[model samples]
Target: MTILIALLSGLVFGVAFGFLLEKSRVFEPGVVVAQMQLRNFILIKVWFSAIVTILIVVTLLRELGIVTLHPKPVLLIGDLVGGLLIGTGMTLAGGCPAMIMAQIGAGYRDAWFVVLGGLAGLAAYLTLELLLRPLPADGPGPLTLAGLSGTPFPALAVAVGVGLFACVIALERLRPWRLDLGAQADGIHHDRPGSPRRP
Candidate 1:
């Protein structure tokens, strides 16, 4: 019964996430690339909001004893290097793993190429495992500000969430999107690359 509940919850969350991605229009190649180039702030706003939201929710669940916190030990060097590679690939491909799926759902035939490239990269990583031998075996594990400062996780999460929210608001005020909800009516339109204007 627990397993079934988990599966159902995953399905519901997955659909909701995809819906949000599509509605945000971040699936558009131009919009994704624009975020990478820092000409637009929508994607960052969404990313930070999602992260903070999850953090806060999970923290609450933990506090309520509904969920236990079990963070995995992370290899600092490995994660840093891997993150750089993934970021570079996303910049070149104009979409990340989740965004690629959203793009395909939006009838972007080009997203197939990105998917193929991702598969190829995964294959290469598995085959070239020996090349990653230099990754540090022992490194600092998860070190959140709460852990470092001896603050409660809920308090830290709430503070981080508030800071991120303020940043998003400031960004929106500074460089507002030209077309808000009206952009959706126009289809998946996007402005030229590097321009501050957006769909």
Candidate 2:
């Protein structure tokens, strides 16, 4: 019963998140490509806001003893190389893992190639494990802001979240992306087939 509840809740949250992704136009290839090219900053702002929100909620829960924070093992060189590869792939494909699904939901038939390419990459990584084994895993392990700075994690999270949120706000004030100006007041970007929405 607990497992079933967890699955159902996960489904609900996933659906909600996907809906938001589509609505935000983060799923749009043009937006992703533009962000990768440093021509647009809306995607960064959106992610920054999300990170702040998550930090606030998670920090509160952990502080209240309602949840425990599990820090993942850090492999600096492995992460750096993996991040480079993933970023390159995202730039070329114009979609990350979640955004690929969002693109499919938004009716982009071309995104299927991105999904297939990702799956193929995963398969290649699994099959070529011996060749990839040389990527170093030795690094300063699981260091968090609290551990490094001697502050409570929750306090550190709140401070960082507020600072980041403020920076995003300032950036928006300085130069905002005008993706939503054309959106309808009724909240429907487009209703007809072949018409694009700003989400």
* Segments of candidate 2 deviating more than 4 angstroms: 1-8, 179-199
Error of 1 at 1 (Å): 7.4
Q: Write the per-residue lDDT of candidate 2 for residues 1-199, one digit (tens) a residue.
A: 5999999999999899899987777767767777787656668888998898888888778878999777976778888898999899988988788888887877778989988888898899899998878675577778777898999776778789989989898878876756432243211236447767546
Off by over 4 Å in 1: 1-12, 178-199
Question: What TM-score would each prediction reach against the true structure?
Answer: 0.80, 0.81
Give one clash count per candidate, in the order shown.
0, 3
Could you give candidate 1's per-residue lDDT for residues 35-116 as a string of tens digits? 7777666677778878878878898898899997776667788878878988888888888888888888878898899889
lDDT of each: 0.76, 0.77
* lDDT for residue 27 in candidate 1, whole number 0-100: 64
> Candidate 1: minimum summed lDDT over ten consecutive residues — where?
180-189
TM-score for candidate 2, please give it: 0.81
Candidate 2, position 14, lDDT: 82
